[model samples]
Target: MKEKVLILGGTEFVGKLLVETLISDQSKELYLFNRGKTNPHLFPNINKIIGDRETDDIQKIQAHKWDYIIDFSSYYPASLQRTLDHVNRDLKKYIYISTISVYDFNKYDRASSIKEDFPIVDCSPEEAIDQTMKTYGKKKAACEAVLKESSWLNSVILRPSIIFGIDDPTDRFYYWLRKIKKETKAIVPNDGTDQISLTYANDLVAIILKGISGDIQNGAYNCITHDSISFNELLETIKKSTDSNCEFYHKDNEELRAQEVFLPLNFISNLYYNNDKIKEATNLSFTTYENAITAMVDHFEKEEWKKCMIEIDDEKLIS
Candidate 1:
């Protein structure tokens, strides 16, 4: 008997990698539930239900009893609630690809290490419906709230910090890669004190696979294993891995934005998580920063390079 698996968003980034990993396993039968808009041709042999999860179209998925429903698409609570109404939770395990953004920065006074038990940002009714990037964390918190309310849901929430890998449409991490590869001098965000945690795609997929194969406990777990990296350490890693000659200068994130310059990962507090829970549950290690950089460098192509070609007046910032 084949294990029925349905991926809510299977065409992009981490979700795409998840699909690829499952394809190798012959015991799992895969089904994709997406709008059929993104990279539709990526999976030809797999069964796909093309519909918007926000509307009644999501009902199409309820026809089958799935062994696992991996959701990467739910941003708001309403969407998740609607989808859950259609799910036969009697037999399926649910895995949510949540972000570490769910942690409220206001809860901390400085760079502090947080765990799954930490207080998440509260989502207002207005913020729940809005789709702007500003309300993203709150809305995700709202979705998590829905999961918490559903006491019967056999769900495992995996909150990952800044995800970095190949085929990443979001040019956050790739922005640094481009700067290191092309430019000589660049202005990095803030002083070198701010530390950030990142999750490599391969390691994240391994934890998700562990949940799928084994009986994972129902709760949220921070998916990153590495301790943390400071702002200077991040740039040095990128430079060392690529052997680039880029000179980095210091500038506050707000200062750069005031000059009409937008940089990625303008984080306020430290993103380090106490990952002892995940570490104890699964004996999985992570990709070293150097090796993860190599993977991204190897996969960066003409399109990705073209994305890096944005005209940023680094000289103005440097001066």
Candidate 2:
């Protein structure tokens, strides 16, 4: 029988991209679970389950026996525990969508390249249950530990850098772009020297699916492009791509830090990844940073990027 794959949080950014890729591969059956809202059209042809992970109505999830589960939405420790209990024990692979925030944010000054072995935040049991607010990274680190303890399945944990593309509503990078577009002088933090990691949506999805299909084992991997670009270079490239001649007032990292202007995009790394494993495993090369930023600018100019604009309803989650 073909492997049955279930994707939780199928409507969000990475989840939506994963569904698109899975549907194109005819060898597998795809199922999506969410709250029956958001970009519902993205998964028009797949089986869907509507359930809230927080509320614990696992009935929609318990009915199916999936060979692989791509859990893109598991955040809280309770959700992670619930997922382990609900999935079939015989599942071949359990892929978890995680973040680089699992690593220490303060360590960027020390290392140019952050490996998967980097230390993540520590969380207590109480912190895991209330995982929504400031304790997000701590909870995710705890959840990773939880899945690693499971002896039943081969768990693939992916720690991706700042993910940006057309459908991303987080406004992480777009805020800068919008500021550049509207103002005569764009203010950038840290003299644009602070190194940052960026991954295109398509590139991230490719890595996740390739890891799953190849039966990559229960270890963790950092998903990123081979190259690291400074924030100044990123903006310059975008301006060139868009033909915008706006002047940029560069501020050193210290100044930006002093002013506390949301200068740096979070979940950053110094362009770290030993893609040797992924290359040997799947021979997939990620999209280049310059090309990725250019593509993002094109999407913005074409207005195709608005798909990721966080709707007012969804904005409440972060606010």
lDDT of each: 0.84, 0.72
Which numbered prediction scores highest in TM-score against the true structure?
Answer: 1
Model 2 stretches astray by more than 4 angstroms: 105-112, 178-183, 252-260, 264-275, 304-319
Tens-digit lDDT track of model 2 for 1-319? 7778888887878788788778877789888878877876766768888888767766568898888888888788777887788888888888898877788766555545666777778988888878366887888898899898888778898877778876676887776665555445666555677667776788878887876686466788877655667777878877766667777766555544554544437335354554455455557777776777677777787774344242222122122
Candidate 1 lDDT, tens digit per residue, 156-179? 999988888886777778888888
TM-score of 1: 0.94
Ten-residue region with minimum lDDT total, candidate 2 = 310-319
lDDT of 2 at 115: 69
Displacement of the residue 135 alpha carbon in candidate 1, Å:
1.8
Q: Evaluate model 1: give its lDDT.
A: 0.84
